[model samples]
Structure formats: structure tokens, C-alpha cells
Target: MSTNTPAPVGSSGKGASLARMGVFTLAMINVSAIVSLRGLPAEATYGLSSAFYYIFAAIFFLIPVSLVAAELTTGWPQKGGVFRWVGEAFGTRLGFLAIWLQWIESTIWFPTVLTFAAVSLAFIGPDQRWDEAVSANKWYVLAIVLAVYWSATLLNFKGMRTSAGITKWGTMIGTVIPGALLIVFGLIYWGSGNKVDINMAPGNFFPDLTNFNNIVLAASIFLFYAGMEMSAVHVKDVKNPGRNYPMAILIASLITVGIFVLGTLAIGYIIPEAQINLVQSLLIAFDKFFTIFHITWLGPVMAVCLACGVLAQVVAWVGGPSKGLLQVGYAGYLPRAMQKTNKKGVQTGILFIQGGIVTILSVMFVIMPSVQSAYQIISQLTIILYLIMYMLMFAAGIALRHKEPNVPRTFRIPGGKHFGMWLVAGVGLLGSVIAFLFSFVPPDQISVGSPTLYVVILLLGAVIFAGIPFLIYAMKKPSWKNTDSANEFEPFNWELKKTNTETSAPAPEQQH
Candidate 1:
């Protein structure tokens, strides 16, 4: 198959055309994928300094990833996402590793987000104490997580059309509406002269840099901005991607930061720092705000909305990285069994395998000492795994500048020569490396049981998950490749170059 073929276009019965997406739609897609209200409460505990973390992460992680991905996606515009970009830069082995981390980090991340969904569902009940009790119950959390996750996986089986619709509505009702409401309530509270819990002092806006413990939770901010790269896959779909992608990123970043900062401040305004619970704080903040507004009845409605948002987020993620991995599998990286697709062309086998992993991880709720600890541990693992991929991605961005200088880029980072690529991607790489190292330090805010266990789990988990792609690459058989020429994955550029060089080399001197 031709590697450089433009993305397929259509306008007929067998292949109805997809309308090209514009800036607003793409921006909202990025918003839906990256903005999770649940994280606000944790950051809220940082008071004014939360804004610092938000801005820092946006600059170092969010913007860099989005810009780098835009360049890469537009330049390649191929079936594989990171797999294609990194493969072109480094080679297929590291390329597979990048996509593997993307998929697996997201896979491990399912339980933590679902756990938040379970908590939101728990709060739908009348009694707050009863809600807390149910939320804390490992069995209930596991049951809800599995039910919601598997349900989403099954729904995705229908195809992207069904999934996209849910994400759009889910994000509106669940994320945008709730965030706006929280900010409005905070405004009303401040306007009404109720005391603000967070210090507005100028000095408090920046976090204390000296304390390592103080900065440990900041590592997770990278995760808060993690999935922006996922949206880059659609760079080809956007009109004038060079212009539109950056506009979308700018608009989406501002809106996202606004929602996060205001939402966190709203929660901090209502719930005291001591009372912030990672899973329940967002819901609790909503409940408290509604109580003050004398709209206690809206509490359950907010719970349902947030839960829907979480479900929508899950549905989006469930299909996304798996689709990329499926393309790689079709290219002969995975065993033949993994490449199976359903009637709708969904990756049924891979989706089921993903679900199975989620199911196994959800079971950890039962074995861990507490649901919160389990959530923290899984979240940290996700962050570290994803950071490794980001490191590879940033390095790949810089390397590609040198390796394929003449490749036409619709958009390029600003500086001349390697300077722009290095500055943007270099900062991202440095930030990711710092976060990855800091991720090993357990936050003192929670009782993670044993520091030794936490370190061991993270180190081992990263090793095993990151190492699997290499093992798969080693075991890959030529027979595993899809025989259909149309569906075949394009070989890496390096592979083609090596072939050309070998073929052009002068014949070896005769032996005698």
C-alpha cells in the first residue's frame, strides 16, 4: 500500500461523504476530550496556586503536544497516529512503543475515571452519608465501573457516528453546563459578599517551589492535558489545518483553563480544603452550591450530568487509541487474532481485549486498602506511562526536523531551522521527564499504604507496559500481516530509504 496516499475522500452510497469539520467543532472535540471536571477539586485544594499549575501545564504540556501533533498529523495524514509519526522519526519498534503507551495508559486510566463516575452515581441518592458510604464501597465501585465501561465498549461496537453523538451531548450537559454553573454560583457567592475560602493574595498565586511534596500532585497536571494529542488525528479533517488547528487549540485552551480555574475556585469557595475528596469533591461542590441557591433538587440532576459526561469521555477514549493500535496490528505488529473487525468495521477483537483489561483493573478496587488509594495509584501509573510516550513524541518531533527536512509541512513551529522545533518540543520533553520522575514520589496528601509498594508498582508497571511492545515486535510474523493490499499499513520512511540505499549500492566486488 502507498504510504503517502492522501486520506480517502467519498461522496456516494457505498461511501457517503463526511463533511469537513471546522474550527468550532474541532475545538469542542478537544474540549470534550481534555477537560475533566473531576480534577478541579484536587487542584482547588492548592488555592490560588492552582492557576499557576494550570498555566504551567498548558504551556509546557498542552500547547506543545497540540502543536507538535498538528505538524506531525498534517505531514503524515496516515492511518496510524503516533505510531506513524514516531515510526517515521525513530523506527517501528519505538513507534509501536509510543502507540502502545498511548493505548495502555488510557486502558489503565479507565478505572480511575469510572471510579469518579461511580461516585457521581452514588451521590444521586437522597442522603449524603449514604452516598459517601456507597461511593466508598469497593464492591459497588467495581460493579459500577465494570458496568459502565463494558456498556461503553458495547456501544462503540455500533460505530463512530453513535459514539460522536454521545460525546457531543455528554460534554455539553456533563462538562460545559456543570462548569458554567459552578462558575456562576461562585460569582453569585462572591457578589453576595460571602467570604471566599481561597486566599486572593498576590503572593499565594504561585506555588512554593522548594517543597517536593507540594509539587508532586502537580505531576498529574500533565495528565489533565494528556489527550490533546488524540485530537491531532483529526488535523487532516479540519480545513486549513495549519491555521485552524492552532486557532482551535488557542480557543479550546482558554476555555479549558477558564473552566478549570473557575470551577476549582467555586469548589474551594464552598468545600473547605480539609473536606476535598478526590472522587466526591466535584459532586459535593455542586451539591453545596445548589443548597446555597435553594435548588437542592438540582443536586441529583448534576450527578447524572457528570456521570453522563464521564461515560461520554469513556466512549470517546474506548474507541480512539484502540483504533490506532488496530491499524498497527493490521500492519503486522500484533497477532492476526487482534486485527478482527465487526460488520461496522469496528475493531471488535481489540475492543473486547481492552474491555478485558479494564475488567481486571476494576477488580483492584477490591484488593486495594482503599478506593482513594487505588485511584491515586492507577492515576499515577497512567501519568507516568503517558509521559514516557510524550517524551518519545517530543523527541520524534525534533528528530523529524533533521531526518525529513524537505517534507512539506502545512504548519511549522516558528523559529528558523531546528530552533523552533527544539524550543517547543524540547520544553515538552523536559517537562515530561520531570513529571515522570516526580510521579514516583507518592503524594503525602493520601495514605498510599507503603511507599515501597508504590515505588515498586510504578517502576514495574512502567517497565512491563512499556516493554510489551518490544516483545510483540520480536514475535511478529510476516504471515500475521493483513493480505489485503487496500488495508495494508504503509511501511516506515526509514524502511523505504534503507531499501533504496541497498538497492542503489554498487554490487559487491566479485569474490575471485
Candidate 2:
């Protein structure tokens, strides 16, 4: 056999050195770009106040989840990521289910987010009746929806490099840039003697936790922040997993909070709560702002950016979750058909299945009387699925501490083992349960189906969809396990010790 020259050895501990990352970049990527969209007309539709209630709602639920996710991700960096972590914590079945929920939710989520982009695209002018076109001929929206879905699907076929490029630029240009401009536009209007009558009086500013609607709204917001660990899968790929992970979360969190607060304030300044259209609300704000300011020219430009952002968001969603699901598939949780991968390592089969499911869900636009109704209906299923995943993930966080007590972790929750892990896990558990309970109550405003129909759909969704994994688990056997891939990721504790030796960090006890 012809032998290539032996590669030179890297410096002592040089391989481990490659694992460090700065906090800011990690935070920027982990922080959400989509939070502002939910805060605008969406929160108003749920009857939340702009100030006290909405932000309080987020702090109690969203913020904690982000922190918890950051801690777990840094602690456990694996190829399967969440699946591996949860599997080690719980069992193979529950882990499969966790990844399943994450994967399925994204597919269901496609139609809803795409509709947001389509509505924003309609903002070009009074002349372009995109929304009217969608309503008048359902197939028009269906076609565009399919176009977006397939385009996103094919983009991923080139592998994650294409997806990453989209996510990075899409987030900056599509999310941050547009969000900042909206705030600036609102501030300028306020400076020009245009007063927006916002109901920020004490009572209105605080969200009524006692109110069923507001409580459910908070639950919904909790799910909106559910994907904090979505980027956790990338930890191993980063230059330095441990340091970069937490930093990235922190950076992303700051960006997310700024956008939510400022963007909502902008919307409130431009349009009153009652007049906000849950369906086409962003446009309403832009329309009103443009009309008063006479910068009508920027309307379409913003719409284009928003549309491109939505497209990027869709691509991100499409690639991320399906890749996780593909992991689940390789674990024998899914049929071998789904395990097919191309030379470049893209999972073409799963992408097709995801596209099909999205298409089926998209047909809801035709059946539901209003597009907003379709959004609400499809969204309920997504929330329910997400809550189930949160429950498993939270429980896994606690279980991992006990089951793999000696596992090497870059960061562990601060409190003593008995208290810290339980406390953090408890918060996630409680929030998830509360979200699950409230998901059944149809929103007071949007009506996709009757209250009875909502309850039936909720039960049907929880039982049928959640049951899919059990069937797969029942079919599992020793042969189902792939011997080659069975080797779990083991942190190089010796190398870790040498690296931390300079800092005098204590050696961690090795787990079996």
C-alpha cells in the first residue's frame, strides 16, 4: 500500500486548544431572531399588556429556559446532541421521542412562519394584493408555500455549509437590520409630534395572570422560546465548545431581549392594540408608520427584507431539526428508509418526508376560513409537541446528574447536586406542564375550529402523534443497534486535566 508522509504532530494540548470560544459569538447565534414577531400583534391578540405583563411573562418562563439550555449544552457536547444527552439521562425511547417532537414541531411550524413572510411581502404597496390573492385563491398561497418549502429543502442537500451561510447572513440582514429600522422609524414618528395612543396605563401594562387568556398567552410565549438548545447541536463544531457555548447564549439573549422590548414598543407607538391584525399586523404597523412619515418607498424594501428573513428562518428550521431526527433514525428509531444519506452526508429521504408533512399541513389554509385561523390551529399542535419535548429534556437534565454522576462537564449548575439540578429541572418541568394544560384552551380571538373541536384535536394530536414512537420502540431489538455507531462520545478527561492544570482546576471523577 502506498503510504502518504506521516502528518506532523500538533503541539502538546494543541488539539484541545482548538475547543475554546469567545462568549459574544456564541451568544449572538443562540439568541433568537424571531422573538419580536411574537411580541408585536401576536401578543396583543392574546390580550397581553406591552410593559409589565409581557416582559414579566418572558422573564418567568423564557429567560430561565435559555439559561438551563446553555448549561446543559456546554456540559454535554455530542454528535446526537439533545438525543444523546437525553438518552443518557433517560432511555433510548424517551430520547427518540424528544428528538421526534423537535423534528415534527418544525415541520408543522413551516406553514405558520411562511404565512408571516407572505403577509410582510404584501406590504410593497396598496396595489399588490398578496393577502387578498391568498384568501381569494387558496392555491396561490399553496404554490408559494410549496416553492419556499422545496427551495429550503434543496438548499440543505448541499449540506450544512449552505444552511450555515443562510443562517448567519439571514439573521443579521433579515432579523437584526429590519428590527432596528422599525424601532428607528417609530422613534422618528414620535419625535415629529405624532403621538401614538398606547394603553400603557398601570392596569393595562401588567398582564393579568388571573385572566385565562393572558395565562395561556404566557404559556404560548414559553414555547416560542423553546428552541434555545437548537444551536446546541453545533457546540462540537465550534472552535471551543465549553467557553463559547455559554458566551454565545449570553450574546443571543441580549440581542433577543433588546429586539422584543424595542420592537413591541415600536408597534405600540405606531398602532393601538385593538386595531392590530393578528394576521397582517406587521403590515398594519408599517402601513401606518409609512403613511404618517411619507416614507412609503421603504415599505416594499422592508417587506423584501422581512420575506428574505422569513425564508432564512425557514431554511434554518428545515435543516436543523431534520438533522436531529436523522440521528434518531440512525439509532433504529425510524425505518431504514429514512436512514439514507448522500455522499455529502445530507439526509435526502427525511427531507422529502418533512416536505410532504409540511404540504399536508399547508392544505389547512384551504379548509380554515381565515389564514390566521389556519395559523392558530396548526400552531396548537406544535405547542403541544414542544411541551412534551421540554418535559423530557428537563427530566433528562436531572436524570443525567444521577445516572452519569461522574461524567465530565465543562459547567454544572451551581447548587449542590441534590438541589441545583433539581431546582433548574423543576422550573422547566413546571413551565412545560403549565404550557401543556393551557394548550387545549383555544385562543379567545382566533377560531380555526370550535372549542369542542379544539379539545378533540388537542387530545387526538397528543395521543396519536405522541404514540408513534411507542410503536417504533416496541419493534426495537439487539439487532436494531448499529455496532459501528454504538460507541458514545467520551470527553478526553486526561487532555482536559492537562489543559486545566495551568489554571489548577481539580480533576473530575471519571464515570464508568
Candidate 3:
């Protein structure tokens, strides 16, 4: 059976032992990697019905991703995460596409998220009008987005130890503590016979599924669950990955789902449906929730915590995919120049490239009609790119079950092997395809510029970004491989088999 012998180039030493992460630490990393509070207010528009959408998405997308990823990571805990998994199933060609999509989607998404973070920063003041005006200023938004993103990238460059430390505390203070507090305050408000805006009647618990626009909004919840697989890249750094990693995924999924579901309900309980503006409603809800407890002073404090949570989440993202690309770089997929790593084994080169992409995309704030327009347009592309990657991941999961049946796995999908793999990965793949389709239909609420132009941009972005990896693969040369001491990678099952099919010869010399 094949084994995932941990590599030395993980965090700080020449041994995997250097970066020993416990279940709690790994779980926190997973949590911070995916959760963001920006979309809760949008979901709050559905009132108590939002819970139905959250639970639906968790079943079809979130849980499937967690299960498939657990099986894939435990069976093949290589450095490249999705790159390694897909490559094993198909070939290096598509695998590079998978990893690049992971990188580029996050690249495209930086602005949307940082814009939210910028708004969070804007709210760190007493006056709502001032906060609204500051958030709308192009210059203020651009500066905050660049500054915060670059700071997170730089923090990740310090390697896993420093990054993980900040992630743990940041997620706790920013997300978990604040989320718990909001839910608690919401309950208090409801208990005190406060005027709740949403009807708690059982009949209002489900959204109108016949409405296409509602599905468009609900489909976005899929992307909220997107980054779980990225955390698989860190399995090697964890303690007893076979045992602890799967458990961590379950723990993180629960925390994230709870925050998203209950947090949205908190907002719905406080704010009237007619007044819910996606941009300001969350802060507005927080303010009213604070007022209920007679602690309106804590409004700005909550804003700061939300910003910290975003920064922590960005740090998690900044590390995972870039490191995965670095692994593929050593295998000759990326240019040798981009394969460099620091003393702490962080991929500084790729981070710079990633930062450069963000810098360019951030310029759209000034180029577009407004920051909101830029975010609305660019975010569609982000969803498209990421759903494509997810589709590939789900396909790879099912393929690997048959293609490498003998490979030892610490965790497998429930039920039997083949049937379980088909069921879980099939559900994930179907969900991704559905989300990908729903992404094109522009929401009825927002004036996303010209709808035709918006759809054109999304289609064109998908084609262009998806094609770049293929171009890279075609242009690759043996000389592109990094020969440095830390660049060693294991041969895939398919690569080994192809080698044996050729002339009977000694194995290819280990390429580092």
C-alpha cells in the first residue's frame, strides 16, 4: 500500500515534528480558513427561513466536502492538497488546473472580502452616517484593503508558527466569541418581549423554492463552504493526522455552520426585513443588539473583532494554496523562479505573486463606477472559479477510489467503499454544478451594472483563467523543476505505473 511519508519542508525543521498541531489547533485553522460574517446579513433577509437554506447547503455541499476531503487527505496527505489528489486520479495536467483555480479564485476574491473588511473598519466609529460615507470613499476603501491584505500576507510569510498563533486567537476573539455573544444577546432580546422582526411561525420556516432569485442567493452559501479543502494542505503538519485531522474537520464544520446559521438568525431577530441592506445591516443589527443590553458602547468594539476575524481568515487562505502551488512548482509545473521558499519554509515568492494579483484587482475600486459595483461583478467570477475547482475535486475523489483502491486510507466515506465514495462525491459534484449555473443569474436586488456585461465578464474570466494553467503545462520544461534540497516530491501512482510500463529499468532518480 502507498504511504504519505511526511515531508521535511513543512514549517520549520527538516522533520514534520517541527510543526506539531493538536486537534484543537487544526480545528481552529479549519474554522478561520472558511468562515466570514459578511454574508450573514444577506441571509438574514430570509428570516427564520434562512436556517432551512443553511441546513440544506450543509447537507448537499458542506458535509460532502468535509467527508470527501477527509478521505482524500487521509489517503494521500501530500503537500499539494487538491493538486496531489486530482493528479493521482487524472494526471498532472488537470491537477495544475485545480491548484491554479484554488489560487486565482482566492486572488479574485481578495477585493470582495477586503472590501467587507474595509467596511468593518469604517464602522469603528460612533456615527453610522460617517461609517457609511467612509466605506463609500474609493480612496479609503482601497487603502484599507491593500494595507490589511498585505499585512496578512506578510504575517503568513513568517511561517506556520506565527500564522497559526494569530489565527487561533483571532478566530476566537473575532468570530467565535463575537458570534456567541450576538446569539446570546439575540435570545435575550426575544425573551424580554422585544419587537422581533421575523415571524417565528412554523409556516414561515421555509423559503419560497419556486423563486429563482431566492435560489441564487441561497447558492452563494456553497462558496461560504468553499475553503475547507484548502485546509487539507496542512494535514502533514498536524499531530496524528489520520486520527486528528478528520475529527478537526468535523469540529470546524460544526462551529462554522453554527456561526453562520445562528448569527444570521440573530440579525433577523433584531433588524426589520424592510431595513436589511446587505452592506450596513450587519453592523446595524449589532448596534441594536448592543442597545438591548444597554452596551451601545460595544458597537465599535464588535466591528474591530469582525475585522480581526477577516484578517485571520485571509491569513489561512494566503498560506494554503500558495504553499500547494509551491509544491507543484518543485514538480516542474511552475517556473523555477517562483519555487523559492524562506528559512521558515514559507512560500514568499508565490505570496508576492498573489499580492501582485490583489494589487491589480484592487485597482478596480477606482476603475469601476463604485466599490459596490466592482465587488458585485468581481465576486461572481470568484464563485465561478471556486466552483470549478470544487467540481474537479469531487470528481477526483470518486476517481481515486477506483483508480487506487489498494491505497490505505485512515478515513473513508460511510457505508462501503465504492458506493460511499460515489454517493458523497456525487452529491458534492452535483451541488457544485448547480451553484455554477445559479451564479450567472444576477440577483434582482442589486444593480450590478449592465446584467449582460456582468455575465460577459464572468464567462470571459472563467475561460481566460482556466486556460492559463493549460498554457503553462504545455510550455513546461524539465529545467523548470526546482532542484533545491527542500523540493523533493513523491511520484504519483500513475507516474510510477507508466514508468514500469516502459523499458524495465531502475526507478527514476529521486528529484528534489
Quick one: best TM-score, which candidate? 1
Q: lDDT by residue for model 1 over 197-260, one digit each (tens)?
A: 8888999998889988988987888888877776676666666766777898999899878877
- How far residue 154's Cα lies from its native spot in candidate 3, in Å, is 3.9
- lDDT scores of the candidates, listed in order: 0.83, 0.66, 0.79
In model 1, which regions exceed 4 Å deviation?
Answer: 1-26, 233-247, 505-512
Q: lDDT score, residue 169, model 3?
A: 72
Cα error of candidate 1 at position 327, Å:
0.5
Whole-model lDDT, model 1: 0.83
> Candidate 1 at 162: error in angstroms?
3.9
Clashing pairs in 3: none
CA RMSD of each candidate after superposition: 4.3, 8.7, 5.7
Instruction: Evaluate candidate 3 by giving its C-alpha RMSD to the native, one decimal.
Output: 5.7
Clashing pairs for model 2 are 19-240, 20-240, 23-247, 26-248, 27-247, 27-248, 27-251, 27-252, 31-252, 53-207
- lDDT-superior candidate, 1 or 2: 1
In candidate 2, what residue range of length 10 has the lowest lDDT sum?
1-10
Ranking by TM-score: 1, 3, 2
- The TM-score measured for candidate 2 stands at 0.83
